[model samples]
Target: MAHEKVNRTKFLFKIIFIIIIIITILSFSTEILFIPTSNNITTPITVLPPSFNSSEEKFLTYLPHSGFHNQHDAFINAIMLSYLTNRTLIMPPILTNYYPPWSTFHSLYNALNKSVIAKKYRKEHCYIKNDGNGENIDNFCDNNKYSKYDNFTMLNWDQLFDLSELKKHVKMVDRGYDFSLDNLISDFNVGENDTYLFIEDKRFEFEFFDNDNSTRQIHEDFEKKFLISDLIKIDKKLLHFASLFHINRIVLENQHNIEFRHLIHNTLIINNSKLLNIANGIIKKLGDKGNYIGLHIRIGDGIYIDEAEDNKILIFNELMNYLLESGLLRNSKKFFKYNLKECVSHNLPIIYLATDANDPRKNLYKFYKNIPCVFTLMDFSKDLENFGNIPSDFDEDTNLKSFYVPIVDLLVTAYGNFFIGTPKSTFSMAAVEINNLYHGKNALVALP
Candidate 1:
């Protein structure tokens, strides 16, 4: 009888233990469910600005007005967030439905291809209107196909930003010098908001003017009449609040310069644990046992200002040498720089992603000969299959949104936006900013 009683007691304890374990699992599942559910719940936006009592609070204004490329949106958002406490982002009015032109798409494909040479690749092959510009000029001429539509025109920088709807929200002040950096800062400060947003067409006010949609022609004519340094000077001056680069503006040309260095020093860093985890996950997936480094090289004509005469091969050599000497590449404590030699020696792999494929001039293998890397070109293009089903067309006046999941993930994971591209690209700048934010520091080193 005593033995039976002891067995019953043991059975009762087992049941209790099982119940407790089940309860713990249920609790954990509920917590996990709540997190994602809360993320999906959208907060209602209140348009009113926060009430302020201080009169000394100066507003910092950010002007990101032009709507040329979809990549510019990231830069626009970065500036808005950077100066969030004392700033407001005044978006330019949306213009016509715009998509990237054939030339631009062609350039993107070429850049991606060269970046990951000898890798598998594919892109969305769609029949966009070939209105006889650049490569399509011959196609249109051969068939006498210029007269598809008389009103089908490209959107100008100024035309892209109508601002009629936003006029009521903004008080217009004539900056005496017309888009001068100093004038932009003073006019937008309404005494309440510390950072105000005032934007205009830099090309029209300071760079070039175009009444017709002949920007390429206007750029050529303007270059003869002006200097790129003049625009660079204005950019240097305006680095205080934010400079929204459109039309291929993101790059590291001026990264080593004083002004950009100063900008980097002033910003704060916010690290995202999630981003770090994602990066670590990628490294493990690639079977990276030891050293890893990022080699960011951009190809295609669009990446350059005007395909400057410098041989890209020489540029690649210079960049590689810089990387070899940099501490990030030399030191194995925190970072392990991987190059062609190191990849061969250590059997390290590379994760290369590009925007284009059909370019001959880019020397892909010469720089990354022995490096093993992952290429998402094929898989990435596959996801874009259903993009055409969307009701909206790519609009030049407004920004066109693209989903580059693999590239974005790689960029974010590596914390590598600083060394990504040219100065005239918002895409590169935003990438750097995002990487910086992910790494939890404003001043990030893109070693080469």
Candidate 2:
């Protein structure tokens, strides 16, 4: 009878334990966040970002804007700030040129290839339109492409970078297109009662300069500096910022803090296996590593086109000076006279040009005139894939190739023995970071 009583007691304890475990899981699942969600997206965005186990832990997120490199800078800042504030970082989706802000990766790529936007991107298929200027452009989708509703996509953080690596430093929640507060509240039971802090900057590009003495440089450049102490002290469940990185927005003062930020920057490597696989293959085929020079010329956008000649001259002068001085060119005077095939016969130094300019050989012949051994991505066109599904009738997808080539260019350039880039170019700066990671002390990426 006593044995029966003991067994009944054990069974009751087991039931109670199971009930407690269920309650614990349910409680942890009710996470909360306050932010802007996508506008009229077709697919339902689920709040799958891991919730904080502890009540004290909050989150830090910001608006991701501009091109990929600029958005990358924002992500770096987001993680650093999240670590500083002892909060989980809610990383925003990577915004590609075709993609709207906060749109996920797959959605962005798929829309670019499958939707009406695909017609616009594959410029060859679209009927060519001429502005008053003689140049024919492929901008038919200029109106509908920007609509967050129509061409909606989001790039999960892990697609570009390794979250496992990021998680090593700070806690992070993968916010894959879950931009809506309504969805967040529904998924995690976020209540209106929850304290929310939103730091929206009225300035065009907000910057947080953290320094004890605001120097003349800061006085002239920044409108005003926000107090770090005030930011840290704010007791809000969700702390958000706006336009954090236009030009290295936050500057860490303390040695520990600065090192931490640097570590995160170093940690932010291009871990996407597909990118590396393509890049590594190129690097191997581009001849043995550290034997060639990588040059990135940006002449397609903004002031770059206007100053293309000057850029060309500066790059030419720098390369000539470097090659002659470094003894890389055995016969400097004769190097230009010989043809590329002949240069190959002589085993001259290889100079790979990564540029936005169309038909670089015809448009910018001067660069090749000086360095006959110059090679562009065109040299390896067959090896590199378009990465988009072109229609059976369409022979070439120039637009899809255009979208992918920049990243490939960046990666390939980063592995070069020497890299020369266009000044004030964020893509160049990003290449420098990757170069530093690979070459470290030997990194010699010069901006002209």
Candidate 3:
């Protein structure tokens, strides 16, 4: 009976073990069927950041037509306007007649450098591309090849800024869109024309007898209007007043002139390495020898005007008298006693003359020939040859070198020990500003 019980217990144990194994297999099979696989898994969807607000509340301004210096003035005013109105400035491409239309910023400056500069400034300001849509536009150098547009060529902004970030805020406009300041301000919908516009608004002509009071009132009025308006287009009038206000504020606050100087320098980039090298060489040569007088003679195109010849002669005489009084030049007697000896020993009596005059031996050139040491752009003929032949008169087909020559001359003039420029000449004005900043003095000025 005991043996029978032991066999029965072993059979019961074996039955229990088999039941456990079956349950384990069922559990494993259930898990294998129910667990998620790669094919069945769901992924979280990603979304891009929202685009800039497409409301009419944003203000836009078009830079007016003019030469490089005037265009630059407009640029500065645009910046001030944008800051005041909290608007995104749509900058016009730098325009020149050399290409019979335009030369883009990229054509004149380092693309990579421009990008870096734009990025640096955009953090504090809203600078957008030509497209109204805030899309990042890169490769400004390649994108703006067809610069010719409506009797004007479009130059790339990369000559001034990287513009990639600014491009993001660009509101693209359709061709031949009405860009009038009144229309832009009054229209409910600007459409693609919102991207960029060029207008010839009249200059704001308001004389302020009391600058402080007038500027304060202007600021107050602008702020009040700007806060309520959905769209504020800066007409020439507003721009002029705003520019005056800001400029006065800067002066009143005793701000460093370097701020303006640096801005101009940073924006007006010279990309041509050969041109830049030549300019640097000239500046260095002048510095190495001794103090030099820099003079800008605006006589080339002036000859065509009625009284321009008389004006030129007057300006020339005034400049000479001023130089003598300022001790930059010695009188005939002083020249023999001091200047002549110094010129012979150290090249102290030298004149670095920059002029639009074509003929080397005629016109204003004759006035400068008597100087002990005189140099003009022609002295750098070998270096300029690298740019190919330059035309005597710029036309639709003028070479890039011809367009760039003035910039090179401007750079050399800016580095002179003392600089004098002609009245109302933007080229001279730019040189004076640059010279003042570089030399830490107010030594640059147009003839009074």
Candidate 4:
């Protein structure tokens, strides 16, 4: 009887131990599953959405009113700002108003082959003309070749936010003749309720002897309140406010956000089949003859107003020297059976020149005419006809077609083996960026 009682007590102890272990496992499993749900449920109450409907989200919209490169800059800044704010981004149309002939806005799809915003955000998040209620004014979506954001609503910057509150939060900063980088960094402090920060373009304005000492002093006093040196410096702060409701106008003062720049470049897809075919045709044409050198000669409008001849010669010589030193034209005998001068006269090994000169034959073309293999958009004039009614001369006054010409030129330049572009030209910068991304070549900048 005593041995049986001992055996019974041992069995009871084993059952008790098993029950405790099962309880412990269940408790741990419940925590692992329920903790995340609890956090998600609490998030909405703690963090307010930046829109009228609590469920609807607000986004960053960029109004690009400048030229191609200026618009390109705005696009880059908008992407970074959107990432930092954790909000959807509204892609701006390529503003062609800078050129009088093409005075209408073109969709991002028309300008680029792919929609970077669509790739990154949900269908409802990104707002483009196709995504909103606006009519397709330019017929960019006639073929249904690109992505559409029809569900997204278009809201102007002023319409989305309280301008009075925005003005109060924005500390007007003025940095006269000399832009103080130090003062710009110290002025901005992110507040809990501060949803957005607007940095006026005039804050970083500096020109040659444009303002008086009295005006400069007043600007300096204003800087004491708030200031920002450039877009790069505030990257961290922007990232911090990204999760919250905040809109920031990127300070445009010669700063390159390389990380975001590369992201934008990689995301852009050239969706226009017509442009793609033209670009491919140029590549195939040059592929038959050895590698080609792409040159961007920017000589339109005010470019020639000051030291025109000198600038032209300087750029021309720079391109020639680069070709010679880089051994791109080292085997003259194989490509062209003549001396260097004769080779240039014959246009040997192909030199693809992309210029804005009204008459290529009259301007730099005269210098490169002797070269055995020099080609331009005029060479593929027939191919351009497939798109629509383009100007015979590819002139700036071809209405909507004016925008297409430069974009095609940009793609051709990017596809080349070697590229040399003029300094401070956004068109060249964009071409170079694409070249670097696609061809893995470092494009040379023609120093003047």
Question: Number of the top candidate by lDDT?
Answer: 2
User: Least accurate stretch of 10 residues (summed lDDT) in model 4?
Assistant: 238-247
TM-score of model 4 vs. true structure: 0.50
The residue-by-residue lDDT of candidate 3 on 1-448, one tens digit each, is 9999999999999999999999999988865552322221121111111113435234444433445565665555454334334444545455544222122222222332233333333322433334422342442222243222212223434543343332232222211223234444444344453433322122332222211332334332222212112223333212212122122122111122233333334444445566667777766666532267777777666423454476557666876786678766643544433332365465455667787778644776545544445677776766667667543221223344645678878888767776778766778877887677666644332211
Lowest lDDT sum, 10 consecutive residues, model 1, at: 117-126
Write one digit per residue (lDDT tens) for candidate 2, span 183-233. 543443344655454444343333454455545244334565665555677
Q: Quote each prediction's TM-score.
A: 0.36, 0.71, 0.52, 0.50
Decide which is better by lDDT, 1 or 3. Answer: 3
lDDT of each: 0.34, 0.61, 0.47, 0.46
Model 1: residues >4 Å from true position, as ranges? 1-292, 302-311, 322-353, 357-363, 370-420, 443-448
Q: Could you tell me which 10 consecutive residues in candidate 2 have the lowest summed lDDT? A: 390-399
Ranked candidates, highest TM-score first = 2, 3, 4, 1
Off by over 4 Å in 2: 1-54, 100-152, 184-189, 193-205, 209-221, 330-345, 386-402, 442-448
The TM-score of predicted model 2 comes to 0.71
Local lDDT at 405 for model 3:
74
Per-residue lDDT, model 1, residue 269, is 27
Model 1 C-alpha lDDT per residue in residues 323-395, reported as the tens digit of each score: 5565323324322344334444554333433333343224455443422332323323433343332121222
Displacement of residue 340 (Cα, Å) in model 4 is 19
